[model samples]
Target: MLLDHFDYEKLLVPLNLFYDLHTGGPRRPIFHDVAATRPELLELDRNFSAIREEVLNVLPERASIPRYHELDAMQTYISGTVDKDRDWKVFPLNLMGVKPKGFADRCPRTVAILDTIPGLFEAFFSILEGGKSIPAHEGPYRGYLRYHLGLVVPEENPPSIRLKDQVYTWKEGESILFDDSWDHEVYNSCTQDRVILIVDIRRPMPQPFDAVNRAAQAIMKPIYGGQIARKLATMTPPATDGDAPAMAEEKQTDDKEKASEELAKKLPDQADPVQEWGQREATGKAPATAGHSAHGDKKPDAPE
Candidate 1:
């Protein structure tokens, strides 16, 4: 069952808060230091064509690929029923630090490139269906920074993400990096799916804290065990009666379309309030919090 996470894991809250307050990096909407990464992330850059090729191979099998929340319960709010018509799927290479056994072999060239990057925390290909809109939400920890290398993007009215006040549209082969701590939302308004290579890397911190952050991140592997289990089992083995299953899937799509219409009527515009809150927090008018509004839930939970 999909779980809408509304609170932070109790034990990890303090540590997450500590890093958010004392981290050495600049606090901004978008990060501009890709070259600062250890080893320069050139491996990913060099294998762009091969990586995109692998993603294109996976694209045709979107039905078999799991939805984001199906893999990680914590992601249910954005990848939940509210965006039913706009399916958000993922093809994961790694979650936290654990690599799914035999899974990387399917995308050998991409995995080989990923292996070269230092402090690699999470790596996956985010596949957003046409007209999908991920509600306003954020990751709690500042220990990691999110990176995206656009692979398959539609040229006409390309997909865009609003991080704070700035909206960035994805361009094929372009890279975008930012801290996910601030409330951000994504939308694929074009009537074409958008695919991007999403990776999370450890944020560079000073001395002992840097080491401490790495040790703390290890705890997330066990925490996200459910997601890993689902990812490992995502590929559907062909059954003898394939047509029946295909019909069932078609019905599911119809149900999703109905659900999305109802969801829109219930969930209010998240941008207005979240943006106001972000502005207040920046000026000390409001206290910073991991929780952000999503799907009309009681309180939003911290995401990875």
Candidate 2:
């Protein structure tokens, strides 16, 4: 994720040019000194180590069990098959509703940077050892992008990853943010363990409204449909009491009906029957009818 907001158009030219140059040719090395682009990579390494320690200390032992697996026929038959190696697995910590204690104080700067990027509410530092490789797979959600910040890079054997056709390696303290919607995979061929701070962030798209709408739909799908609609509707300012014309009209009709009833009781039994009928019709109490009553002479009571 970008720490500073920049003109994407201006940045895209260089990015596309670099991508084209690196990906087009017969696999050429695109490894640049991570220090060249970002000087703060060193600080990230220190912070990452501190946070990792905190996470390991704070998280329950049961939560630390590695969930990723290759394949199990019995488990797949019961719970459905999951490509353990292909999928990116991590224990998410520090979400809005599920923020852990001491998280904000321990990693304030890192969290602040991540907060700027949308859809990124949590993070995880993954431990990948020798011969561990994540197979090629796309992200489940389309709106968000993923980021990898390398903390510990093995000197002898470092982890390598390929995005689209361009292969790249991780450098200690350096970070790579990319759209996980694109096909990507990782390989750790080295003898030592490779540790990286894996961050997932909302994709920076041209149309933010569409992206937000889609995110909302995904989040609300599990709950009742009507309940979600009502929640979204509440986001809009409610109708003002002063602007309720319907209520005012109903009140006026009630007042008129009360006045008519009072007047009818005071008058003679058969006085102005047609006028009373007309008033009732006007108030929506009776249907319209072609009838007239003058001087108390009834026209067959106008069919009641």
Candidate 3:
């Protein structure tokens, strides 16, 4: 049921403004007719399943309790059970971190389609069967839209999600793109398991360049995290050594002070009784005696 006629020109203006105001936009039922792509999605599911296995093996042990009820009422089956574990969650589009090996190269079709727009393409696999739900949550920022392409939808009972006013039933091969910044939740009511491939893309914004910048940040943030990404965003490359004469002069001054300090250490010390007593007091050494001291001369060492 993939949509063939996506009138980019007609939607561009609203989309752009949506991006400007919300920092992202939502398109209702973008893949209303996406069931036609089921074959491709099935293949993707198989590929992702293998990847999921490998990812789970590589991940560290889970510590936190799984939040199952967040998705929907059916989540109880998958939630709270130690047996149920989510392994190898991969966020599509190098968003916020290093892009996993083979992810970009292997999923070329998905990447190509997503590249045409601005966003990420992610895949998730759940090991638990039946009644798993993702808790209600919003997207990180308002600059992008999210899409879910159902790859492995249980046959006995299907998973469904509510996005704002709409109720979405999982249809293998169908894609649903929506404004994830809005409240949303999903539930797998079926007796079987479910799998989905998700993507987060930059919605059309007033300034295309700004969108691009945000997208790059979104991609890098996963790898670098929020703090580092913000720092990187604000960072300006250092100017070449030749660019600032003032900086050069400051460095020279620092060097001269360092040299003078070194020379002073090598020279013989001048002594004063009062100063020597002050030095001893400062150093926490016994106060210099009124008598001749170790300095060999009668005068005391000078204060530092």
Please tell me which predicted candidate would have the highest lDDT against the true structure: 1
- Candidate no. 2 TM-score: 0.44
Clashes of each: 0, 0, 29
TM-score of each: 0.71, 0.44, 0.43
Tens digits of lDDT, candidate 2, 132-236: 577676443443345566655676768888776667787654566555545667776776656667765443344444455355434433332233223323332
What C-alpha lDDT, on a 0 to 100 scale, does residue 7 get in candidate 2? Answer: 24
Compared with the true structure, all predictions reach lDDT values of: 0.67, 0.45, 0.42
Q: Give the top-scoring candidate (TM-score).
A: 1
Candidate 1 clashing pairs, residues 3+ apart or interchain = none
Model 3 C-alpha lDDT versus the unseen true structure: 0.42
Q: Which parts of model 3 have CA positions greater than 4 angstroms off?
A: 1-93, 102-129, 208-304
lDDT of 1 by residue, 213-259 (tens): 88877756555644465556755622223354576578666765665
Model 2 global lDDT (CA atoms, 0 to 1): 0.45
**What 10-residue stretch in candidate 1 is worst by lDDT?**
292-301
